[model samples]
Target: MQLRLQQRLQERRQQSLYRQRLTLSSPQGAEVQIGTERLLCFCSNDYLGLANHPQVITSLQENAARYGVGSGASHLVVGHSGPHQELEEALAEFTGRPRALLFSSGYMANIGIMAALLKRGDAVFEDRLNHASLLDGGLLSGARLQRFRHNDTDHLKQLLQQRADVEGKLVATDGVFSMDGDSAPLGELATVCAEQGALLVVDDAHGFGVLGANGAGSLEQAGLSAREVPVLMGTLGKALGTGGAFVAGDEDLIEGLIQFARSYIYTTAIPPALVAATLVSLELLTTEAWRRPHLQQLIARFRAGAEQLGLPLMDSQSPIQPLLVGDADAALRLSEKLRSDGVLVSAIRPPTVHAGTARLRITLSAAHNEDQVDRLLDALQRHA
Candidate 1:
């Protein structure tokens, strides 16, 4: 068994499908010292650049000093602290929902919502390109999972129509497609779900701190409401530059999750200090409109430059911009060339992306300036 497992892993490496980690010598920012090289990177999801903000770090330190580390138990136990409660309330308000529930990670939150709200006889519809966690949750829910074409609401509607004979239906999608770097057709999707009498779950992982007037997320960006879209899941990791994730909806939805979401109920809670840090990040993410606009400027700068160069850029208004290089080897080669040029952008290959559509997943951040964007463009132009 061990030999077979090792052989299969080696097959991944042979195909350039293996992923490796790089150690950062400092906090996430525009540039980082990876080993000995100070590479200008365009791969971090720290959209507003609050990962290293003084206020967030100071809050974490102060809270940790008072509360110490690990949450020590689950929220159902004695571990649910004041900071967690306050952050949850703030996030609920930010999302324009009646209530919100936090989980250790986006994956856990996705799993919890799907498993709690769905069951064997119900129908679950998902966008094919949704985050792996959402797909996993759909599968685990035993909800007769049927995936539509990426962002194809018509296809989703057709599937839901077919499944009208079933018990109930839940239609889930990533508000921002993870690898493709595109937005789901939320306006159409919301209407489809409403007409079909199905619940819509929007995982706004990539939109939480970058989209909408107040940076609420893609739901708000689409002018949708809790009554319209229902279940909303967003992460603190990407734009908020913190850890953990949450699901927000009505009071009933939250209370239902509390009673039945296995992922939330059984697991140990995340650290209280991390929650404190996230609270600070939430404040900055909400109040500092400049960071969001600056990030938009960076995205515009990067995209316009890439377009002028005729690079294969995807249709994305968000920070995640991918250049779809057809083969895994080609994507890896392009990434290596960029890295050698002292610019860092990760080569995204299957199964992170679809097998044939390997690419460089270039994520912009507020930490980067126009010059850095130009530097990346220069490298890409040469290699592309």
Candidate 2:
């Protein structure tokens, strides 16, 4: 086992597909400290820039003092605290759902939802470029997992028609593609699901707290409701600038998950302090309407600048703007060059993305200013 693992590691290095973690010595923000170097970062998902907000920190601290740090047990046990309940209620209200159930992470929430709702004879259809967690969930659910073309409603319709006899049908998609930053054709998917009697599940991890008039996520931005897209999952670690995830839906769904979702039943609940901080973050996410527009401005500025530099930019209106470099080695080289130029951008490679589509996944944040966006553009210009 050791020799085989070592060989695979060496092969990954040779192929320039090896992954490494960078040590950060400071809080998440537009600028990050890596060791002694302070870099202008463009790879964080803190879109609304509340991760390090003073009020959020204070909430965490105060909650910790009151409720302690760990949840101590699973939600079904003696673990779920006041902060957890409050956050779930707030999230349900924010998403306009009947109820919401919390999970340790988005991955867990996806896994639990699929496993609880699906079985050996059921069918799970997903977008080709859906997140790894969603794919894993389908596989684990013992269902017939079929992946349609990415964001192609026609392909999804054909698949649904082919599987028309299947009694339990669930269509799942990422509200926004994480790597490409493109939104799913949600309205079309919802319509198809409604017509076909299939349940539509949308994992809006990247869209929540970043899209919609009140930061209610992709469903809201696309004018979808709980009736249109029944199962809605979102993460607090991204735009809300906190940790954990939740699935919001009608009361029946939440009750069913509580009874059947193994991930939720087995694992310790998320930290109450974190949940407390997230509640504050949610308030800010909706009230501070300026953050979204400013983020859009930055995205536009970066896209325009990248276009002028002849960089390969993908079609993304979200904060995630990836510049496709095509080759893993080239992407890594460009990322290194940017690091050398005092900018921090990460190289995303297979199998996170498809082969030959390796790129620099540049994420913008509301914490960034016009000057910071220009700095990234300048670095890209120099490297391009």
Candidate 3:
């Protein structure tokens, strides 16, 4: 087994698909310290730039002092605290849902939702480019998982038609595609779900706190209501700049999940102090409307610059801007070159993306100034 594992690892290295973690010596922001070097970072999911916000930090510290670090047990046991309950109430109100249940992470939320809602002979339709967690959830649910073309609602409609005979039908997709940085056709998908009598599940992990007028998420941005897209999941670790995730829906749905979702039932609840921080972040996400526009400005600047450089850029309006490099080795080389030029961006290779679509996953944050964006552009132009 060890020899086989070694051979597989060697194969990955040879194929330029081996992954590595950068040790950050400083807090997450537009600029980060890795070892002795400080690089202008364009690879974090801190879209609203609240990860290191002073207010958020203060809230966390104060709540930690009160809550005493850990929750001590699962939510059913003793973990659920005042902050957790308040956060859930806030999330439910923000998303315009009857109730919201928190989970330890986005993965656990997806898995628990699917496990509780789906079962044998059920049909779960997904987008080809859906996140790994959603796909894994469908598989673990013992459902017939069918993936249609990415963002192709017509194909999804056709699949739903074919599966019309299947009584238990659920359609799952990412509100925003993580790798490609494009949004799902929520309006069209909702229409298809309505016609097919399927439940629409949207994992807005990337879109929450980044899109919409009030930063409610992609559903709101796309003019979708709770009736149109029932199961809504969002994470605090992304645009909210904290940790944990939640699922929002009607009272019955949430009540059912509370009783049957094993992941939520068995796992320890997220730290109450972190939830306090998230509450502060959530307030900022809504009240500080300037952050989203500034992020858009930076995204537009980056996109325009990348386009002028004749780089292979995806059609993305979000902070996540991927530049297709085609080959894993070339992507890795480009990332290395950018790092050497005092820039930090991640090279996304196969398994994370399609085989020939390896690229640099450039993420922008509101914490970045225009000059910082220019620095990234200069680095890319110099290395390209």
Candidate 4:
């Protein structure tokens, strides 16, 4: 069996499908040291560049000195501390939600939300291009999971009509799609879900720190209220530069999740220090309006340059900008070409993306200036 596994791995390598990590010797920022080359990295999910922000780092250090290290227990077993509680309140208010509950990660939060609200007879309608985590949550809930055409509201309504007899029908989507870098048709989806008596769940993992007034996320951008999109799940990992996620909803949903969500109740609580860092990140994400505005400018600049170079950019204004490279081998070659020119935009290939749509994911952050964006464009232009 071991030999067969090794042979299969070799076959992947031959097919240009083997994946490996690029080691970074420094903190995550616009510029990073990959091996000996200092490249302008454009592949991080850190949109607001809070991952290495000085204030957030200071808050973590100060809180860790006071709180020691780990929580040492699950939240339900007396590990929930003042910092965690404070952060939850802050999250709820920031999201315009009545209550919120924290879990260890976005993956866990989705699983917990679905499993707690849905049972064997329940049904879930989801976008075909939603994050894999959401799909896993539906699968784990033992619900009848149905996939609608990507961002196609008509298909969603058709599925909901088909499953009208189900005890529970929840429609879920990603605010900003992970690989494709497009947003869901939120307003249309919300209307359909509302009339069909299906609850809407929006996972704003990539949108939380980058969109709307004061960066309140996709729901805010679309002007949707809690009553319209009932369950909102957003992460602190991408823009907040922390580890954990929260599900924001009304009092009843939050209370029920606390009682029944196994992922929230059974997992060890995140460290108080990490929560502190996240709180500081949230402050920056909310109050500092320039970060979001500056990132938008950078995105526009990059898009304009990519178009002039005839690159296959996606139809998105968010930080995630993907250039479709078609073949896995072609995507890898383009990434290598960029690396050679001291730019690091990662190639995302099959399995992570759909087959035949492997791409170069070029992410923009506030930590990057216009010069860096120009430098990346120059590198791509040179290759083109």
Candidate with the larger TM-score of 1 and 4: 1
lDDT of 3 by residue, 72-133 (tens): 99999999999999999999999999999999999999999999999999999999999999
Question: What lDDT score is found at residue 60 in candidate 2?
Answer: 93
Model 3 residue 276 CA deviation in Å? 0.6
TM-score of 4: 0.98
Write candidate 2's Cα lDDT for 1-384 as tens digits: 999999999999999999999999999999999999999999998989999999999999998999898989999889988888888898898899989999999999999999889999999999999999999999999999999999999999999999999999999999999999999999999999998889999999999999998889999999998999999999999998999999999988999999999999999999999999999999897678899999999899989888888888999999999999999999999999999999999999999999999999999999999999999999999995
Would you estimate the TM-scores of all the predictions?
A: 0.99, 0.99, 0.99, 0.98
lDDT of 1 by residue, 1-384 (tens): 999999999999999898899999978999988989999988998888999999999999999998899999999997898988998999998888888999999999999999899988998999999999999999999888899998888899899899888768999999998888889889999999999999999999998888998899898889998888989999999998889999998988999999999999998887999999999999987577799899899899989899899998989999999999989999999999999999999999988888899999999999899999999999998998
- Pairs that collide, model 4: none
Off by over 4 Å in 2: none
Residue 10 Cα positional deviation in candidate 1, in Å, after optimal superposition: 1.7
Error of 4 at 23 (Å): 2.1
Model 4, stretches more than 4 Å misplaced?
1-4
The better-scoring model by lDDT among 1 and 2 is 2
* Shift in Å, residue 67, candidate 1: 0.7
Instruction: Give per-residue CA lDDT, model 4, range 1-384, as digits (tens).
Output: 999999999988987889998899999999999778898899999899999999999999999999978998999998999999999999999999999888999999999999889999899988999899899999999998999999999989988998888868999999999898899989999999988999999999999978898788999999999999999999998988878999999999999889998999999999999999999999987677789899999999999989988988989999999988899999999999988888898989878888899999989999999999999899888874
Steric overlap count per candidate: 0, 0, 0, 0
lDDT of each: 0.91, 0.94, 0.94, 0.92
